[model samples]
Target: MAAQAKRIIEDAVVRKDAKVGDKLLDKAFALAFKGLVYAQIWEDPVVDMEGLEIGPDTRLMCIASGSCNALSYLTAGPAQVTAVDLNRAHVALGQLKITAIRHLPNYERFHRFFAHADHKENAQVYRTMIAPHLDAESRKYWEKRDIRGRRRISYFTRGLYRKGLLGNFIGLAHLFAKLYKIDLSKVLEAETLEEQREVFERELAPVFDKKFVRWLTSQPASLFGLGIPPAQFEHLAGDERMAEVLRRRLEKLACDFEIKDNYFAWQAFARGYDRSESAPLPPYLQRANWETMRERVDRIDVVNANMVHWIGDQAEASLDRFVLLDAQDWMNNAQLDDLWGRITRASRPGARVLFRTAAEPSLLPGCLDDAILSKWRYLEEQSADLTRRDRSSIYGGVHLYELA
Candidate 1:
């Protein structure tokens, strides 16, 4: 399974004809990505739902990163959600989340297991209550020991949010901040946007100017933990130095939205969701949506496969929505054409497709063949609006398209 997962990722990310340096970078990214990457997906589900117009009739196909958005979409009562990913670890994580929701005793247990993820009882609860209901593959994944000889499921007890590539990347960022005598958590204390801006300018913004920090950020490999491959790194940097681009992105994350309302910010600044009952959380973790998620948990199907291949097998005009989740940033022209071609064929009338890019503009117009691309209408104005509202602040643009 691990070998096949690596092949699938390489097929999607590694360009066969690329130069040696590019090929090496892609290979490195695939290796890093084969294991757990996103402990919690970074995209804002609320913005996703708003952009997709999710409803009871919506049948959505999304890339299952951490399964956060897929599970959250259940709250909107979608008819069905098919989440496909190239990584087996993500598939196992998604399956585990679904099983846990179905078999866990109550909302508190569920809450404690996921939200208060550092609690000591979570692993035991998983073994006793959740494991019995899990499929063998997922069960084996959690039971497996890491290089440190710790069972994978023990992450819940020790701080699940602090594991994975993204988690460790944030931890590393915090370490760098501490090295400069700046406490990143200070941004979390701001009560208003003005205060947030003040905190960012005072405590965060200037760090980008440090010569050592700028040099570190300039290396393409430095962003591997953020799931950025060499190809996407160039797009993210564009004409600016990577340090400036990172500073702008971090500024948005810190000052553009209220810390109390942005769970993405909480994860970035606090390393987990806020513990308060009123703390902002992804839709799947909110108490009001808990019953809905539980009731609709079975509506999702998790598949470990390349999304393009999986979609190719589906009947034409069958899917109503697609959430690509920055996966396109990893693709070359041929792959993009193949993906959009399948997407166009599989899309139902008025079907909406949503995705994010590392750069501000959509990557489609010039890259995808016009014959296939012309069949979909890009919602330029609405896409720009959603981009501004995305609280994650990590992506450059949130794009939406509809079958024309």
Candidate 2:
């Protein structure tokens, strides 16, 4: 499974016939991506749910990054969510979350195991309660030792959010801030948007302009932690310096929303969800929605496969919604055509497709074949609205398309 997963990721990321330098970077990205990457997906599920307009009858298909969106979508009562991913660790993580939800005794335990994610008792809880019910593959994945020689399950006891590639990337960012005597967490102390903006402008924004920070951001490999491949890095930077682009995104994350209501901010600044009782959380982790997620968790089918290939196998007009995340930024024109061709075939009438991009404009305008692209209409105004509302703030665009 591990070998096959690596191959699948390479197929999606590594472009053959590219220049030598680009090919090397792509290969390095594919290799780094083979292990655990996103312990929690970066996309905002609220914006996704709004864009997709999920319903009770909705049959959704999505890239199951960390499976957070898949589980969160259950709150809308989708009939089925087929989540496909090329990473086996993500597949295992998805399966584990579903199994843990079903097997864990109550909401508090479930919250601690996932939300708190640093309780020493979590490993014991998994062993005594959740492990027996988890599938063999997921169980083995948790039991296996990581490169650090510690069992993978020990992450929950230490800090699950601080373990994956993104986790380490954020850790590095914090370390750089520390080197400059800046506290990234200071943004979290602001109680109002005004104060948030003040703190960001005064503290975090200047770090991006530093000589060392600008040089670091200029390297394509520097953002591997955020899961941005070399190709996507080009799109993300566009005409600006990479540091400037990053500064803009970070500014939005810090100032666009209130800290009290944006869990994404907490994750970015504090490296975990807020611990306060009234803290905002992903829909799946919210106590009020816990029962809904637990009841509909079975509706999610996590598969270790490429999404386009899996959609190609589904019956025509069978799927009601699709969530592509920012994956299209990683694809070439031909790959995008293939994916949209299958998506067009599989989409039901009025079916919605939601995806994010590294740039402000939609990638489909000239890249996707007209035959497939014309079958759907882009919701320009609605897309703009959701893009602004996206608390994650990592993406440049959050686009929506509906079958027309």
Candidate 3:
């Protein structure tokens, strides 16, 4: 099984020139991602929505990490949205969301199932309302029992936010913070940015700079929870100490974004959503967007496939908005060119492409074919601006590219 999983990873690597070590590392990443990586998409949808400027005419394509953003895009009234992920688990999760949106009785019930996300009744909601609407594969993925005799869907009832690889990683981070006598959750109570900064400096910063924390972050395995592949780790960790890099990013997460409405910041500091704090929820989960989401839910198609191949088969000039969301950081030069080739082929005139990277500045300048690269105008200033506003302050950069 392990060998087969490794081969799957190798075959999925778009770059033919990927080194053996890169291939092995990608295999580990693929294996981990296949299980359950993100329960919630981390890239700030607010930042992405601002960049893409989705409209009724837009046809969207994205790498569906957790499907939260793709579903969120539906609220923008795009003509169509298709999300592709190599991980079946993610695809299944997207499918389940679609099912829930379509069949659930109301927004309150839906919010309780996902955002509140920890009540035994959620399983009953799933079996009675959501399960019947799901396709066979998604249904099987959620309904299948684990060794503990618990159905995967039961995670919704046990705090779904605390479950995936990213969630567990945050939980570990909180544990480590506690070891240093710091309670990271206190960052949530700060009513102002200054207060947030003060709290972070007084509490979070000292613990983060601790020797044990620094050493743990320096190791590659420590970041697997962030869904970061070895290649991405190398990209983000270049020259600088990983501890410092993390501290800078965490500072932005804690201080730059207001805790009152920044759910991403709340999640980072508290390891859970601030339900009573007026912290804004993802658009898909917001009560106001439910009607739009339900009306357009049919437009979202979830596919489990390699993104490059999926984009390759797409019709010319059909897609208008592309959200890569840090996946390019995992690609080598050849893989990047291949992926961009497909994007260029599938993009309509005036298509806007948005992606994030683990390092500042876009990766396409020297890596992709000049012909294809020249056809898109890099929105450098806007990307820089959006990166600063990105509530999920984990990425080193946010990039926007528009067909020229």
lDDT of 3 by residue, 96-154 (tens): 89999999989889888888889889988998898877899889888887557988898
lDDT of each prediction vs. the true structure? 0.92, 0.93, 0.85
Pairwise lDDT winner, candidates 1 and 3? 1
TM for every model, in the order presented, reads: 0.99, 0.99, 0.95
Better of 2 and 3 by TM-score: 2
Candidate 2 Cα RMSD (Å)? 0.8
- lDDT, residue 386, model 1: 95
Question: Which 10-residue window in model 2 sums to the lowest lDDT?
Answer: 1-10
Candidate 3 lDDT (Cα, 0 to 1): 0.85
Q: Using lDDT, give the best candidate's number.
A: 2
Candidate 2, residues 1-404: lDDT per residue as tens digits? Answer: 67787889999999886899999999999999988899999999998998899999999999999999989999988999989999988998999899989888899999999999999999899999989898998889989999989999999999999989999999988888888999887899998999999999999988987998899999999999999999999999999999999999999999999999999899899999999999989999999997887788889989999988899999998999999999999988999999999988988899999999999999999999998888899999999999999999999999999999
Candidate 1 pairs with clashing backbones: none
Compared with the true structure, what per-residue lDDT tens digits does model 1 show for residues 210-319? 99999999998999999998889989999999999988889999999999899989999999999987999899988898788888988999999989998999999899
RMSD of each: 0.8, 0.8, 2.0
